[model samples]
Target: MSQDQSSVSRRNFLTGTGAALAGTAAGLVGHSLFFRPSSAGAVKQGFEWPWPYTELDPEKVRKKGHAGYYDGDCAEGALYALVSELQENVGAPYTYLPVQIMGFGGGGVAGWCTLCGALNGACAAISLTSKDFYKLSSELVAWYCETPFPSHTSNELAKNGEFLVNKSNKVFKQTVSNSPLCHVSVCKWCKENECGSGCPDRSERCARMVGDVVAKTAEILNAYHFGEFRAQCSESDLAHSCQACHSKESPYEMGGWSRGKMDCTSCHIKGHASLVDPHHPGK
Candidate 1:
């Protein structure tokens, strides 16, 4: 009964128009990636690395995750559904994946809302299927930044469901997130939709995002398998202005706690820089 909506983000020149077109074409090709045969009876069972990308019904995948939301939360729901689908088709070793192990990834580990459970779940899937996990997962991380929330909505808007109705009493709409961290994503939603972190609507919105991630994971993985995939990291993926000062590659270290794929402001104050932005010293 989630509110229904369609979502699209502005395709920016921050990346290239050519790359966007290519990505669209690759996505349109629709899930024909080469699956390398797995080691254990993989040849016999006809399994492979880089599982073929399959076209997903966003609502179908959303419903799949939401049905299990109460039981396992976001990471478990999404990861289990995707892996289960592969196992059903590929059998054996594919089924050997420990799906429940992903539960810790949600809500920034136990509902605190850190790294997105969607990325956490999808990354686990990428690690299992691709040797190019970094490149593959990078695509996902970038996509999360570029995409809007609740990108797909349920078919029927159930009034009884946890739908966000703004002060105007209008159903809440989607917004693009420039950050990959769940904490930021939730905060933005709370501000724009006029909802609280603990609201049922907030939880539903994030849960619905899982469906988009799973669908996109299939798209990117499928493209990766077929050799059509390209890494699409945009300048937007970085807080490059701050990276020189805060990145792990920098001389300073924070024991890896103040580090990750997030936008810097997701956790830090932005007004002052500890170090100069070498690229733009005048600023």
Candidate 2:
């Protein structure tokens, strides 16, 4: 081939390759910018586990939780109340969170009547926002096991039409379940209120329960964010005695076979202690 012809061919090849490279680079830059998140926007940049959190008002969360119950029942309502607030406060990841994923947790995990749906939702939110999830979650559950459902504040809110949804204005008789199990909580409330579990009054009671639990969750999360969180709840006195012989920390040979901090009396009879020696922990 002639030198000029060969030189022109080489020049053309270089020009084509350079153009292709430039186009590729521009595409990459555009892609990065488009997909990169910003906390400044409705979705934030940080996508790490235990997402960022800021202080939230418990009263505001309480109202939202009640409304959310009407929207998606107990679990979804509790989670939506907390995460939706976070979406407004921190944007991004929290906003992107699909709270409906927790809908199955309603009525104690799809009505199987296991863990309380509100507690399940609160735990999910707590796990998302705090590394100390277990500790905080235990505190929340303990508080629930002792605190009466549909608190006076919640009843007043309903009476005054302050809740996002005013399903009932009647005051409910509050009862402590001493257990976090949904069946126990609901049955106790039902027995006290003298209503069927499927009754509107029961539903309203659960709605108020969602409000109370989510509000407490908000308060706990806010305290943690501000470094003011403290564990105000602990294992039940009955549980402490039972755990002395049956928990991971127990020194007995047969002890440490059991795990968890749930109230022992909830599932087991106090007669179990009599089976052991008089010197047993509770004895």
Candidate 3:
């Protein structure tokens, strides 16, 4: 529950900290359908970082992580998806850290539902592998915002997963979630896709997105291990235009905060007009 300031790795202070998701039962459908997650599950006495890192197949991880989502939780799905692969390949810390610890990150801690739990899983991956977590996290987040997602399609669960949705008929209608917040991202996708933003489906969408995040994170870690990881997006790749007009740098600043290559409407709902309309000036 507490740690000394000198100790650096703050996986202890992460999103899913309690025993498991609250207000949920403790059985097969209790929450941790895969593994029983406790706040103390992943933590060991005098635990320290620079934890062992292994490179698993990114494409393989994409498949497994998505299936993990079907195990009934987003963060857990991503965690088991990638971590299990690492355990299969080269096992140690993977054996140590349980994927169940991430169960509370769906929406937000304890189902309060804020930041996308998929992103939380990615953060966990960063926390486990890299001391430069912020650098990797920042870049990963920017890419998430920029890319239209649930970017990949899913049909079958096997290694040679079948493609159900052809290029012609729509299956997953993708949307770019400018912010990492779960509700915003998933809701926007539903609206854009004309799916009407319902249950299981929205949950399904986030679950798939979890696959993308986890698999991409695997690629990042794999490349980092192989001397191929490069940070291509940062302060410059983020929102220079929006910041110029709305950030403190501008005389027209709206006391603006946060920076990224996201849509202008990701935040401003009413007080300000949206820059996203097709008829807008930029278009």
Which candidate leads in TM-score?
2
What are the root-mean-square deviations of the candidates from the true structure over C-alphas? 13.2, 15.1, 10.3
**Backbone collisions counted per model:** 4, 3, 0
**lDDT (tens digit, per residue) of candidate 1 on 178-283:** 8877888888878888899898887767666776688788778767776499877663534765565555655654223234556665555533333434333323
Model 1 regions lying over 4 Å from their true place: 1-59, 152-171, 244-261, 274-283
TM-score of 3: 0.67
Q: Which candidate ranks first by lDDT, i.e. highest?
A: 2
In model 1, what lDDT does residue 221 have?
Answer: 72
What's the lDDT of the predicted structure labeled candidate 2?
Answer: 0.83
Question: How close to the true structure is residue 52 of candidate 2, measured as C-alpha lDDT?
Answer: 87
Residue-by-residue lDDT tens digits, candidate 2, 152-172: 999999989898888889999
Indicate the residue-level lDDT of 183 in model 3.
Answer: 77
* Candidate 2 local Cα displacement, residue 56, angstroms: 0.7
lDDT at position 18, candidate 3: 34
User: Ten residues in a row with the worst lDDT in model 2?
Assistant: 24-33
Candidate 3, overall lDDT?
0.65
Tens-digit per-residue lDDT, 1-283, candidate 3: 1122335222322224533543342332221233434543453232235566777777677767767877847778777877788778767756777788998886655676687788888778777777667678777887787768876444232223332211222357778877877778877888887775546666656666777888789878877776777886554323565566556444533435544445555665534443445443444
Query: What are the Cα lDDT values of the candidates?
Result: 0.64, 0.83, 0.65
